[model samples]
Target chain A: MVDDEELTPLHPNHVKVLRVVTALATLPFVIVALVLEVRAFLFPGAFMVPVVLAALYVVLRIPLRRYHARGYQMGEDRLRVVKGLLFRSDTVVPFGRVQHIDVDQGPLERAYGLATLTVHTAGTHNASVTLPGLANETAMEMREAIRAHIRRDTM
Target chain B: MDSTAPTPQRTNPLGMIALAAQGLGKSALPLVAAMFGLRDEFSGIALVLVALAGVGGIMAVLAFLRWHRLTYVVGAEDIRVESGIISRAARSVPYERIQDVSLEQTLLPRLLGLVEVRFETGAGGKDELKLAYLTAEEGARLREVIRERREEEAVAGVAQEAGAEQDSPPIFAMGPGRLLRFGLFEFSLAAVAVMGGLAQQFDFILPFDIWDWEHWMELVAGPGDWIAHLGPWAQALGIMLALASLAVLGFATGIIRTFTREWGFRLDRTPKGFRRQRGLFTRTDVVMPAHRVQAVQVGTRFLRRRFGWHSLKFVSLAQDAGKASHVVAPFAKLAEIDPIIRAAGFEPESDTLDWHRAAPEYRTDSMVLVGGFFVLLALGLGIFVNPLLGFAPVALGMALVLGEQVSWQFLLHATDARQLYSRRGWLVPKSTIASRVKLHSAEISQGPLAQRRGYATLLLGLAGGTLALRGLPVERARALRAAVVESMTGTDFSELR
Candidate 1:
């Protein structure tokens, strides 16, 4: 069970696109800040270019490191997750508690051979985790394993 | 078969007429009010109002027709209601699927000697069925007939269980005193309704009212003497006013809640499930299988905390809508809960040792980041534009956010079996639940800032919904996740160290 590699690395391009989308979301805020800075320059006042740059750097760097380090291991008993930038974390989801599973991909993910897995549990709405940016074939295989576990455990 | 026995037969035509009137009020009141407000417009406004009145009258006629059209034929396995005028629809509710049966008698129905029966199904609001305008006696007899059938099933179940372990009976009956006590004590809904009514009458914050300072002062001070001058009388008046308001509010609320929740209230044991009945104007009957209870929550509010009363709520799929199938027993001091727990077929007491409190990781960080951002905006405005805006407002807002953040605390407990209990809340605390079977997914999330703080959040998904626990100790959250996954698949699992 420990040796079973249910999760395979996601496509690098998919990981890149995810980070790009995140950075693009912050673009409007950056534009607003830049406009404010230009206004401040004309008026000889305080500007926030340094803060904006620092935020952009942090946003791109974290996901890059996380994608590089991220991996998942599936056993008959639990679904294990290994992910983190500096502080690593491993999450396990057992078959008995998993209410259902969702496999999803956005247009970007589809272009890059990546998919995400979402699991649900009963007591806490937040029990399940989504392992985004998984290789498409690996995500399909993992989905099958989770489904098989659900059928056997439910009986 | 009970078919040979004589059955009472009577219907309330007047009550049926009233139901039609109520149905019309629901559909036509807005139209009537709109036309009334436009009465001064082109003489066509009068024609509009007349048209609306005619429509409302037609609705009343239709409602009565529908009421007369409804007919229920109870079979050994199910009860079917065949009604609906143009597109005739039939609702066939199997006995097993019924969550509860309520016999409700509104003020009008009570006067007319009629009761409205409501059949609450396991699913959402759309599944519920209603049969109105039956005589009260007929309603009671029908309820008894259902109860007797359930009892026979219970006896059969007990005999089977007795063959195995000689266990006690599965059902417990509440005494009349207990019912009355439950009715008197559960009154939060009533308190809220009264507060809403008072807020509407005195809209002090309305810009128009704020401008009418003289009118407010006159109303407050009355004709001559200022309000403060009547010292002792003022104090007495204040006390009496508060009590009178609460009493009227409580009475109105208690009666309504009791009518819906305790009307024809019955607790029955059956071979397949447990049943509860309650309602006033429209009774709701409910049932749920014992094995399907995913989680149990025993909750007490500030009011009930003093009296040690608890309301037991079940996380069951069958009855997932409205109030679900809950037992609100007042005076449920620790001793009373044991039987209720047993009745639920689950051990009442938690098995795990009270582990260390799991503090939320993002509590301080989130409050500081979000509060700091807002404070920065305010400070920027103050520095660049208006010094009059002052640091005091921002300071107060930051303090409030920090105060709330500091109070967030989570406790995690695990049973010898796969059961895990996680409860966290501040101000109005709530219990976080996860059963072994309901966990569909879990993820440990962190961004640039959260990673630095050595924290992550776990997102859990349940049958009806999802919740995200943010700013949790990453290591502990990981360990908890592993335990949940292990229990779920029945495999030996280790923490993600």
Candidate 2:
């Protein structure tokens, strides 16, 4: 799914948060296997070993790949977000159609000094295009520029 | 902030009852399920009352919080709403960006002297920022304020561009008599499908259930082995005849609903935009401003096509009575539809347009997309049940593939400087005319195979929804995309907003 043009990649540290989230997701399966082993069921190693490998593969490989795959660009009057590795999609949001903008930071994101900038548009398809794993300062600048552009466009 | 006027006021307290009543109705099923499982049939009535009270009380509290949290502030250049009970989100809609402020009143709300205000900002799906409980006067005042703001913007726009103002007069009216005629041809496959599904689910409850599948299956089991008394061809014929009759029955009921919904249908063109007043009992009114219109579509179903009748709908920034689009002239001659499209700012093209056909590859793509379903179904039925049934399906699938090929021959799309034109579909051909200025966005996509074939599907998203022109050469799609984007670059959307 590689394209001719190289896009602006996401922040490198995003893979760390994604890894943690995916690790927590696989915790239940590991717990179930541990319980089964303690109960003297057919050795949990049989299922747990493969499950751990799969979970580890998913957590370690997928996040870094996805992080590298995600990218966004600020066009003259429209915002372009291109993402996905296998099923790639390119979304364009014209400045005229934008209703609002939001900069969001979760606890994990805040700790990393990263934020996600979302551009809200009127179109049903691609209603809100989010540019994730941005430096907090860059996110603020983008948010301000979007608001200023909206004001200028209205005038 | 404006204490003198109190712009944002609570709705009539009676609206709380209406809210509670709606909540109670929604919760009644679950409450009954609980009582039924408890096996206390005698205490059902008491349980229902208690449950209803619980629902009502919860709704009343939520409604009060919602009302308390909701407030509209009309600023000089913007209108701001501070809403969400817990989240406390603030949304500021610039004055020029607000598309339409829709006012609605249902029976209960109307009786309670309360109305709902929906602020639409041209976002297609769920465009509403709704305040469900507003006093009737407050709703009217809010609408008036927005109207005045729009007028000021329009006046300023007119100063820049002269002769920019236009109005649509009453072009079509469907009286009670015409509604009856309209209902007769309202029969669609969707109606049959819905009725068929409902009958399948609830047939056992009916006293006289002619559609009882179990009884029909038992009767069709046939004397001795299957197909002993009746031949396979005869059995097939019987099934076909029964299906045709069921379709006819469904259409009959669909006609009734059509009559009820469009009894008082009326369409008129005002200086500002197109207005539709319809519905027999509810009497809904919708106004679509001329500038706000996104695209105009002229459609004809198979039945209506035979009669040279067409329906015209407009995709506009304003929500059309919370529907996808507004049906300006539901059932009319092409002569009638032409003028309506013209009013939406397009010179109506001739019926025999020199359309640009899709690439020849579309025939194969469509066959795989559509005929593959029939082929798979046939294979499943043949392998799982009867081998003879398999041959019929293969033939049918081949026939479907043939149909797709024919449809592909007719699949076309073209664009001029002012507008984009596309005529698609085999069974129910729909011609769409979208103003280049109203173009929302464009997308070009190709599968791995299609990329190799050098063809892709180009989707032009307008106010009217996406118009997909499939099987265009990759170069053509890219060129078309560039052209559309160029046209959309500096297009002023003040009107649509």
The C-alpha local distance difference test score for the whole of candidate 2 amounts to 0.72
Show model 2 residue runs off by greater than 4 Å. A1-6, A15-68, A152-155, B1-169, B175-177, B187-260, B350-354, B357-363, B369-385, B445-464, B469-472, B492-496
State which docking tier applies to candidate 1: acceptable
Q: lDDT tens string, model 2, B48-140?
A: 676556567777797777667777677776777787889988878776666767666676776777877777776545545667777877776
Best by TM-score: 2
Cand. 1 Cα-lDDT: 0.61
Worst 10-residue lDDT window, candidate 1 chain B: B488-497
Candidate 2 residue lDDT tens string, A24-132: 9989988887677678667547767777788889899999888876787776666667666655455556666667889999998988888999876555555567888
DockQ of 2: 0.10
Q: Looking at candidate 1, what is the lDDT of residue A109?
A: 85
Native contacts recovered, each model: 0.45, 0.04
